[model samples]
Target: MNTPTRTVPGQFTIVLHSHLPWLANHGRWPVGEEWLYQSWAGSYLRVVAMLRRLAEDGATDQLSLGVTPVLAAQLDDPHCAASMYEWLADWQLRATDAATAPDPTRRELGVREFQSAAAAIADFEMHWRHGASPQIRSLASAGVMEILGGPLAHPFAPLLDPRVRQFSLREGLADARGRWARQPAGIWAPECGFAPGMELDYATNGVEHFMVDGPTLRGDTALGRPVGDTDVVAFGRDLTISYRVWSPKSGYPGHPMYRDFHTYDHLTGLKPARVTGRSVSSADKKPYDPQRADHVIDRHVDDFVDHVRRRLISESERIGRPALVVAAFDTELFGHWWHEGPIWLERVLRRLPEAGVRVGTLATARRDGYVGAPVDLPASSWGSGKDWRVWNGPQVEHLVRLNAEVTETALEAVDKLVDPAGPRHPSGYRGGRSRVADQIVRETLLTVSSDWPFMVSKDTAAHYAVDRAHKHAHATREICDAALRGRAGLAERLAHNWSQADNLFAGLDARRLYTAALPSDTGS
Candidate 1:
């Protein structure tokens, strides 16, 4: 926990955003609940283990971890928690099956998979059986890292209705507080999406800072800047240093010795091949050798440490001050997408401090006076072209229009049906606290998740993405129609039925949608 001073040259911050849409009851293989379980076992389990080891050695401010509310809910959900344990058990069985195979290569692969699965199962029973909340909370409590919260469903706030945006942000932070015992002062901003006045929404919600792409700050990422006239700082990602590890065309994971992510052995659902060459066919790929990969990982770790040290020194010299370089990436990229990622992460984190480069979290940067004067950030994202094109581009124009329509319809219905008085249930319901309005708001929020359109535009699981988007949109419309038509009985029934699968934040009070008004609404 050594603080970087004038003699330290500069500081480096690692931000890993852990997110996946509500995928619990959705499809399983290729792209649904499987995504949740894989990331949980591969990235979450391994990453947290690494952090615990570091913390045991008295490391603080290791990194900033962003767990979106939707993902947090799933991680803590009883159904998902139980299902994840079952998934780990099944993985052990599969590894055993692979171990008994006739081929020596398959036997070797099976042995490796079995050992990994065994470790994962032991870890799950000991720490993750209840859910991920306790583990994440422990890390934050230990001061090992800062936790960043985001909107309820990881929506693209820049395109959402102003009222809905405000509601989502407030409810999101509340959800975090419920899970972790404290609401985060900083957020990942759901894809780093930002618009001209979103800073006001952030400031109103007690957010002291947030993340954005380097281009949003016009490449002045050496220091976080206050957006517009607000005190809410926007820390931009240093893509130069980040891309050195992983990028579109090149990265350490693409090395020929590393395990191949794409080539899977259909029989055992295991990846037994090494990334022999980018253009190499699956049949021609080399068998993965952990020994060789371990050597390469060590080399890559040294290379990355050197890169960060050089970047810090050069950026500090260029800025004429001790600069801050923030490298952010999706948490799933480690262990899940890149099998050797957790190992490399541990090595780099340990190596940087010894290499005379200070490593800390984003919160540390802001508090330690690494911030500069205010800069009005522009409309931008970390997506392709560093703009909103990936989420709102021509390919997904239909979704943009659909989100607007559904948001407006849901808002109108809530306005008409919900009681303005301080009550859990709306005006007409006398039985008890009704959840019809809550379900409506929930469906509407799911419809606008940035993941849907991003999937379609990327053409990865496009059909599934389209189906999920329309499914939620239809639920919103039907429930809103029923409630508006005074069919309270039918509306309540629909809400209850949909709640079976769409449920996540059980404490979400729909009244907040109307009660939490932005400053502009009151003309303050």
Candidate 2:
């Protein structure tokens, strides 16, 4: 399968990783639930709709979408469903307020927002009201996209305790199956973080493929390679292709014509300005024009297709075989951070196929017979320096300590609560004592999300990230203390409260943490 005799130079796959920390009942204003709702409206719903439209136009499995277990849980939460509906309605009312304002630009933007909010509300009511599962399931079932699963809380698995990592991976895949009604064959290793031997876990857990950063392959990433002796293949993202759309300094999103994400209309809680220019002040930026944005999208779509074409042709000639290039990014990058993202994505997907780029899902790539030799992957992440610094550096050392301590305490409590000698139930316990144990594990996982450290290191939303980490940590400690003290009534109350607030992975089993395949070490 590694041999490529075809005339085509390459195959292209786009990987979009979608994730958010558990934010339900956390806060409401500028930071918490608001963030979730915005991403839901701005990104998830819109991107899925775009794909569905493409599917209607005859595209199938054109890309791979990694929807982490944590995000899926929140999307399916009943509380989120009700709250999101209210949020969209509020959006419409705010747009009306903007429309009635004295400024013509504000009025135009408001009209656009009003239409978007109304349409989103209708879409939510018709499709997502029951839960995101049905909508997500329909896309996968329809063969529009391939789903990628990951840890329940999107923890940096390489930095986690073996038991915790293994447990979370297993539980996360289970959670994905429970929601979408199908098990995924591949996973988006949280943060694309991989350590030596992690692929063994992937192989053991039924993961046939996963993505790693291109550097992880040391420049030989034109094909998916097996990890060690396992059949679980690791596909390296082509950074040249991915960074073309989402780099720190220059990317399609930074273009002058796209809607600016940072500039917000304080009165109406909407962004009404175009980027205008890199150094331009938000106050002086010109109002956004969707028509102009659409033009820019078309330009970017052509640029990307051409870039992929040239790279694939060059690589195939250099390597003496057809190449496989993956352009991966966060799913939220589309409708959330980059306002014109979904439109640009649709154009790229459509154009790439027409340009003979062989657009397909990662699963399709593997099935189409591209393969390479096994290699030992180093401890790495897609973060700073392609290493563990962002998640483990000095700036987030406190968070690392916090995560380690909380995880240990949670595991200790579970070990004490569950009978060590009984039949290990799938949810990780024999029976009776599983409720408190389940809550303890849940809090622990939530506390250790990779988001906290990433946010802190990036300084994007550091304070909110800290507060979130502390909140989950506090809950874990309180629950563990109550359980240890034999305060059943108090522990039950605490668990119930936390459950209402951070409810995700409803079927999480704590016994998975005690599996013998994991190392005996308990520290993170």
Candidate 3:
């Protein structure tokens, strides 16, 4: 895998989208808050540590990072920050118990777990005590990476009412600015989802760039392409290179030497086995060996670096310019789902530059002129079939209809209550703003989130997803009805109650909802 010194090298960009829905007051264990804690400890902690190390070594423009507003809100929430600290303390206690187990295997796993847990606790105390905002802001401020922003609730843009879409997108960016002191120029459109005229909304919001699935560009992903007639660039994720790291059937993480994600030791609540074989039963799986996994990581890093080099060369030749290879993934895939992923990522980031490949953030790419001609991207997502099937398919048709109904009802209600000229609630304006209208907008945004239908279609926590959607829809309807009927007392009560849980973006004002007429085609 020697680099050809005679040839010019192309650029490589890694995009990590860090997101989870609002889970502050949600259920715990198997699915709710547990999901947040696991990813925080297993992935976020390690990934940030790796990036910090790289930054210390004078690294800059390392990767593009997307933190959706819904997830950002959770990361910055006081309740979530406190809960995560408690979870880490519990992890330490469990590791101690495991380390003292009578069985040798359990004891060995416990020893390893204890060491990891101690490191996590130290990291949490040192950098994550306040919340993720400071750490992430530092990374961006130091020029280590570019942070991406998204809509308030991560709604599927193409299916949302134009007004809601605009409001959410604007507020989401404002949320990021409030936290990090910079409004992101780029966004990971929820699920890499895009509709035809989204460029107009993006341009309206001053977005300079965004991401989409490679197929959306018809597979010409060697460079970023402008959407429609706007200068807003859409960088397509190169599935060809991305799948080499992770895909449906196979990936580097599936190697036999890597730690197995599914085989857990129920006694200690720690994974204790390697991926001996895809077909090997958990009971017969071999013990996890960190030394063996380290060796495997080194080899895989070499392989991936070579793959990127080769892809860059070939794509450059095809496109008649130095090509750009963008490999994007969910941040949780590392450390959380694939235990060795963070280490592999750090190595890849280090080795790529040494191998004569250019590494930069998406912002850097756009600024460096790694963009091509304009493209009229169609409705698409990175979901099943690279289309809207996972969101709008028959399996979740009910959710689609519900989203439309709730969005329409919410917009109409807000329009009536909010004075078009200013922020005033005709029925019961308090403190110069409509708290009731704000809550209706909040519930409406939650109802239209893309997570519910995605979970149902994937059959992962489907019941919980359905329950969340319905609950939010009911709240939205009730609040809207109360306010519109002049039941100010009831509306205020309901709004206050719902705010106990669905509270984030405290500065949100319903009057900010976009009221301009939209093109007919923008409807769901």
Candidate 4:
């Protein structure tokens, strides 16, 4: 279909799920702090800049951006801010080194890298020294994007103990508020994982909406649906649109002109090659050219805008109502994985409006009357085959058992510390617990993060994931052991050591794990 000649009968929403595991002092190089810094330099910094540009152009609430609490903690952490500055400066120096290399192609790439690094350093010095929270806060305050919260540590909620799941959700929202200065009304549930009854927890926590996979709605995802009689709305990712940009087989990032994410120049620690071809060896890949990438981006933007226009027009007609098409993806896909992603994103957001395709945040779509009947959703995720296998399959069953044991151990230890007759608050945190309980809870959430199993199953940095899970698990077990045996001094020391090693959530209150109605009950 051509560009619309009449008013469209549908709304389009782009939801970018932003998350990274708690990577502050974890490790570096292939995993840990390096991963965080690369994503920050490549994606977050550029995306935030793009949002600000859009806001300056009078755009408001253009998309839903989910920032997980763990990531927020890292972004706002003072040490990460300082270390990231040093990392960026190091990157610039490496580029300078490459610029003098003997190879002409290497020198050309060095020039591009130098420019990017220089600008990033400038941006970091001006806005990021104080931490990422303020910049993110400003974007939300300006209504430039709808912020979506996820459970603390991005846990796989379906497998979590019921009360622990609720606690994570509650604490995650609290984390977001503490950092962003506002509570998100919606969440991009970690991995878009959902089971039946999760909506009830979301509703109780004041969440207005959350996202699920398209199949969760049984392929009829033209509109948001309330799940199981809750006022909380569940939107599904329209994969037809999302896959056009990212998929395993064919996606925009696979384009020959785009920078090859895998082909790095070790001398400078910079990516110097274009994809060239999927089957081509890295040594044979062509050098990346920014000008060529820009040309491809312009074409892709127009094509994408047209695709959205056509889909909305067709879907609205098929459903016989004003449809809501939500395209959701990982925010890191843009600049981190696909180097030209942020530019393409900026172009798409700008061009969609001019192309007569309406663009707004998920909340705006709902508020402007995009509603549907209640749906009883089955278990689902946006993972492999849209099922739970990636997180809970035979391949990662050991992690499943480990998570269960650690969760039980931590919760039981904390439950023993709660006072039965203390002044009770609605949030279950009124009665305080020992600092050991607080430390164990923090370790518990970190152990349950879905990243471990996912990395294991995908074999993408599997060792790092396993090491991290074991590290947190060991810390929790040691802390629990100390607390159970009445070794208060040892418990305090262990907690302090763990806190120094893997501290992310400073405001996490372990008391929140206790259910208010039944103070003694910790979920079985």
Error of 4 at 174 (Å): 0.9
Candidate 1 lDDT over 265-368, as tens digits, reads 99989899999999999999999999999999999988888788788888999999999999999999999999999999999999888878898888889899
Clashes of each: 0, 2, 0, 0
Provide the overall lDDT of each model, using Cα atoms, as 2-decimal numbers. Answer: 0.89, 0.87, 0.89, 0.87
Model 1 lDDT-worst window of ten: 515-524
> So what's the TM-score on candidate 2?
0.94
Evaluated at residue 352, the lDDT of candidate 4 is 86
The per-residue C-alpha lDDT of model 1 at residue 437 equals: 80
2 versus 3: better lDDT goes to = 3
Q: Which runs in model 4 stand beyond 4 Å of their true positions?
A: 1-5, 419-431, 515-524
Model 2, C-alpha of 59: deviation from truth (Å): 1.6
Give per-residue CA lDDT, model 3, range 1-524, as digits (tens).
96564434678999999989887787997889999999999999999999999889999999999999888888888899899999988887888888898989888888899899889989989998788899999999889999999988999988888778888888888778888888899999999988899999899888999999899888889999998899999999998899998775778999999999999889768899999999999999999999989998999999999889899999999989889999999999999999999999999999888888889999999999899999888999999899999999999999999999988898778877875654555575533468888899999999989999999999999999999999999999999999888888999999999999998888787766744421212111
| Superposed Cα deviation of residue 462, candidate 3 (Å) | 0.3
TM-scores of all models?
0.95, 0.94, 0.95, 0.95
Superposed model 2: Cα runs more than 4 Å off: 1-7, 422-433, 515-524
10 residues in a row with least lDDT, candidate 3: 515-524
Candidate 1 vs 4: which has more lDDT? 1
Task: Write one digit per residue (lDDT tens) for candidate 2, span 78-162.
Answer: 8999999999999999999998999998899899999999999998888889888888898898898999988779999988888
